[model samples]
Target: MRVVIAGGHGQIALRLERLLAARGDQAVGIIRKVEQAADLRDSSAEPVVLDLETAEPAAVAEVLEGADAAVFAAGAGPGSGSARKDTVDRGAAALFAEAAQRAGVRRHVQVSGMGLDRADDPGMDEVFSAYLKAKAAAEDDLRARDLDWTILRPGRLTDEPGTGQVHLADSVDYGTISRDDVAAVLVALLDEPRTVHHTLELVEGHTPIDEALKRI
Candidate 1:
């Protein structure tokens, strides 16, 4: 199977690419900078240089042609202002969804924030609030589409090694989860079509990745 990933340079996205390549599946990463292509190549993933921030849906669809699935993992860093949150988080996610439809790709997986409910706090930081709103908007957009979409909302991400265990549910604790484990879950979700149309939250737990997805 072939999967197209947005934000191919991100830590979690790169991990996912390596996993797919290791499994003998093709991985295509969409990056804004041409230089990141080398890094993706090193990880055994093909790279497509497309700036999601400015690209048209038709252009994105062209790259997604013949792909089995698409993953939206792009983000504007914490240091970035709220406007960028709207552009990358909200705007780019929507762009990918539209492109997925145009490309006739029926399956999509969204990597989103855990406990975004807290983002609704009126006193929250403006940037964080904007991110949550963007995430919420992305979720709404995907849920409304005709695609077989699954949203995985993960807790505070860490670089620690994966335990291959996690808690996947509609709501979860605020514990941290490793980027490796998150990638494992993404791959598992892609391998399991039964997980379609479900929105699950993830964090560290004792259940194995496959088992957790199976239970879902």
Candidate 2:
């Protein structure tokens, strides 16, 4: 399978690329900078340099051509303000879905966060609030599309080693999940046809990854 990941240079995206490559699957990463291409190459993911924020849907679709699946993993990062939140978080995700449809790729997986649908109070930091709102909008756009989609909302992400175990549910209390584990889950979701059209929440748990996805 050929998988295309937006924000290809992201921590989780890179991990996912490595996992796909190890399994003899092709991983394509969409990056904005040329320097990031090397990192993707090292991970065995083909890098396509294109800025989703500025690129039109047709341009993005060109990169997505002949791909099996597309993953919207891009973000504006923590340091940016609320304006960027709208552009990269919400807008970019919507654009990716549009390009996917135009490219005729039916499968898409989104990396979203938990509590985005209900978190309306970003009083202390309007930026964080805006981030959640953008994510929620992105989710709405993907759901509206005519594509095979699975949204994975993971709790606080950590850099700890992956346990290959997770608690997958439609709703769950707050908890932390390793980035590696999240990547593993993404790969599993891509392979699990039953996961189509489902929105799942993930966190650390005793059950292994495959079993957790099966239960979901």
Error of 2 at 212 (Å): 0.9
Where model 2 places Cα greater than 4 Å from the true spot, the runs are none
| Model 1 segments more than 4 A misplaced | none
User: In candidate 1, residue 162 scores what lDDT?
Assistant: 97
Model 2 poorest ten-residue lDDT run: 117-126
* lDDT (10s digit) by residue, model 1, range 1-216: 999999999999999999999999999999999989999999999999999999999999999999999999999876999999999999999999999999999999999997667786868988899899889898999999999999999999999999999999877778889999999999999989998999999999999988888788
* Best candidate, lDDT: 2
The alpha-carbon deviation from the true structure for residue 32 of candidate 1, after best TM-score superposition, in angstroms, is 0.5
lDDT by residue (tens digit), candidate 2, 32-59: 9999999999999999999999999999
Cα misplacement distance, residue 132 of candidate 1 (Å): 0.7
